[model samples]
Target: MAENLNPSRNMCSTNLSLLLILLISSPRPAISRTRVQFLPGFDGPLPFQLETGYYLFSYYWANDNDVRKALNVRKGSIGEWLRCNKSIPYTTEVASSLEYHLNLTTKGYRALVYSGDHDMIVPFMGTQAWIRSLNFSIVDDWRPWLVEGQVTGYTRTYANNLTFATVKGAGHIAPEFKPMECFDMFYRWISYSPL
Candidate 1:
């Protein structure tokens, strides 16, 4: 006895098979790569390396739309509004805020300067050196800071109401890498408790 198949089902199957064959046989568009030599508002060819192509496009798409609207900023790209130039290299000498820090310290403003121990971009040693340059006596010497009975990092207090801390095992962005430990550190500092 021959097996019976629904006519509609048979027609659907045939149509799907043909569609798949067409899709598989169709030509794909060629991907072309073009290097960006310069950007608008920048004086010459890009000074630093320019990496193109799509790796993570979502980050580029992210913007503080609400913040811009609240701040009464006209509708424009955030980078343009901020006059940000990605080609410019960030260096300590070029981007030092030490003078402002000194002024704040002299005015008796308490400050917290925290660094990630694993942050090579802005190492803790550099932070220590700058803090020492302020000539503030040590109020609290370097000691282990704890979070939930575990050593989270090290902390030191300066005479000029300044505090320095190292977030242990954290990278450039400590809060992002060690959220709980960073939160505890921030909470303690803001509450005027020892880290």
Candidate 2:
């Protein structure tokens, strides 16, 4: 006796079989976080490589639009950023207020003020001027911090528990430029150990 098969049913079975094969072969997301190797001087084992500053900048801008949208910022033209929003004007009063808060209000809090020695965008001299205006007594005098038996930068601690540090051979992005020193400084500060 000859059996009759439904063409539609056969097609459905074939589709279901293909779907199961795909589902079985696909890679799964990791269940647990993998430990990262702390290689201070080099970037990555990043999932992908960023070759230069231009690449980093491009990545930042490309991602920034999504971030802005998520934050509910008013959208503008495509690929355009709204630089100014007619917000309150900036003045020295703002700087003084921040300085006051840092000097007097944050008694128990630990504050970290850092600069890249090579940063011209916001010069260390200007930062120093403002910090000096705070008049916080120096707990630790300015001295060079050593890494790999060489001077990495200078640091000083203030009576209010604020610390100022400079990263040598660094520019606007100090942490990126000197990852090892930045990590060391961060760890030491967070651990309440000497930096």
Candidate 3:
């Protein structure tokens, strides 16, 4: 779904999506709860990539419009997403407020943050600002690991049970960039079998 996201273009949107994804996706943790965060640098724009800003700007700008596309969509998607999503109307304030609650107010939740060095939407550096401020518990040393070759980065497990990772070369769409690696991470996090 997130194909055009550049690493350095839409830090705000990218970081927001990554944050929400970590909070929202149904967890199947055989081990424990985990949250994965994506990094987007601070300042005006992202690092190397430049299209992210435009993508976010356009998304917000046209968030309310019907925006009729000429392509065919799966049946249920049109009813729930295309038509309904536009109806609910998610404003920047709403988005930000949700983030605050998920990141700070929620209880007993764990997160695993990851980023792609090549992503332009949320540059790795920009993502660090908020993450550094998190004051989360860190019990493990950050280490380099590869999922799919393109989805390789760092892993930091927190004392309270959060696990953060950075996927190599992935942008907003980490799965597309490195499906195997993403799966590996998930499987490991959800390791229900005896280790």
Candidate 4:
């Protein structure tokens, strides 16, 4: 005797197979493209074509010359002025200071790790994750840190004398974006005041 199969089950399977085949063979929807004339960090309209599989590169002066002039370093000084070039060969390598941080914490050294909330270069989320990985107990939970009665940012403190903070409305360069807030935060931290 031939094995019996449920008719409804067979029909459902056939329908599902057809649906899958249709889905697989169907043409994908067109991808719409919009030309972005300007970007946030960039000054004016972009000069290069913005397209798929292409990256735009921008380089900013590191301001080492200004620092050298401010320090009044002699032209023929024996010690070379610090080079602020970002083109160091090993910069792309994966580097972590977690061990050093742990060492410092064990030695009872206090640390403040802050991030700009609006920073695109080194995002706050990544900074938070790095802090979390330290496995330090929270001494103080998240709270808004204020400056002159205005909430400047949020901060949290850990058991190992480590504090993490986010600067409100700041970008990659937090001090440049919010100098007063940064200064206040720094002053409070250095003075051993709660932020």
Candidate 5:
């Protein structure tokens, strides 16, 4: 008698073999449909505030009592009020603003968000938390940023042309604390460079 042959078993085995071969042959990373490029940091003309001697004087000048008087920002006045929310209990409506930032970035507009690592008021951690909620893919992984041969802080760039940076050892007012680093960060950001 001839050996019995099951047609369904043969077909299933053949299909499974073909599927395995296909997967094995294409054992490679899938090419992305959209490519993202990232610039690490700027290596161009330095911003005015970052220039030697200027940053110190400018930072001090901006925070001087004369300027405060001219701006009518007396002690315990609107300037202080604006920095803290203790005077009035309120909720921030920044979610919509964040969405708007993402929308603008998607439309080809660049954005930069920076914070002082040591800031207790409106801390950098909170800022980072909100930024991560935007869900933008990071093109440049976080790394230390350098200025004048010294590490200023860390920086990262996103696919949506958004950059986030931190000013090391700085407070809520990054410029006031780390003026040169802040200047470099802002300069790079405005010039569409990086960091």
Candidate 6:
């Protein structure tokens, strides 16, 4: 419980800790995905600012200012992809983009990409669209586990060796929305990592 109650000034650190927890736990975690909510809303770099809530609910959080600063919240709608990577290229970029990801994923490395179904910040549908474009395939129609309840859903690509999951009642902030499942997924993904 204490671990779940961290303030936003600690959000980034919290993320780092989560990565660590996923690594340390026994039985191993099945999935791990990081949160990116427009730090500076544009800087696309570390040392991101902390000021306003990234979105509507941010105002309701105890660490609103820290969230805003660390998240780099800017004034604009996230219509499609957020372009969060600072190092991604423009030309032959698709080739450059997700290459490290593909490299790690293809060596039988497991990847878990879960989105909060209610998260407009990075919608599940959009994440799926991005996953679809990656075109990772040793085979096709690879499947993953999913619960029919409102809490979660998952789709897998055996061809690409990537799994896309959805948390039903959660929003843009997943651990905040459903910590139990978040930890569950995180623990699983971390167990057998190339990390």
Q: After superposition, how far is residue 95 of candidate 4 from its true place, in Å?
A: 2.4
Estimate candidate 3's RMSD in Å: 16.1
Name the lDDT value of residue 97 in candidate 5. 81
What local lDDT score does residue 50 receive in model 2, on the 0 to 100 scale? 26
In TM-score terms, candidate 4 sits at 0.58
Candidate 6 per-residue lDDT, tens place, 86-113, comes to 5656665354457777788778777778
Order of the predicted models by TM-score, top scorer first? 4, 1, 2, 5, 3, 6
Name the weakest run of 10 consecutive residues (lDDT summed) in model 2: 1-10
RMSD of each: 17.7, 15.4, 16.1, 23.9, 29.0, 15.0
Rate residue 5 of model 1 by lDDT.
16
Instruction: Assess each prediction's global lDDT (C-alpha) against the native.
Output: 0.65, 0.62, 0.50, 0.65, 0.62, 0.52
On residues 68-110, what C-alpha lDDT tens digit does candidate 5 reach at each position? 5554566656442222236787889665687687789999888
- What candidate 6 gets wrong by more than 4 Å, as runs, is 1-96, 137-151, 192-195
What candidate 2 gets wrong by more than 4 Å, as runs, is: 1-51, 54-100, 103-105
- How far is 110's C-alpha from truth in model 3 (Å)? 2.3
Clashing pairs in 4: none
C-alpha root-mean-square deviation, candidate 4:
23.9
**Predicted candidate 1 versus true structure: per-residue lDDT over 1-195, tens digit per residue:** 002212333212123233334434636321212233443323576554333311111122123344345445668634532223467687666577778989999899999899999888889998899888889899989899999999999999998899999999887778756778999999998998989
Between candidates 2 and 4, the one scoring higher on lDDT is: 4
Worst ten in a row by lDDT for model 1: 53-62
Q: Candidate 2's C-alpha lDDT?
A: 0.62
Q: TM-score: which is higher, 2 or 4?
A: 4
Candidate 2 per-residue lDDT over residues 47-159, each given as its tens digit: 43222333223233333544455445667744443233356476654534665656553667778888999888877777788788877799899999878888989998887
Per-candidate clashes come to: 0, 0, 35, 0, 0, 24
Candidate 4, which segments miss by more than 4 Å at Cα?
1-84, 88-94
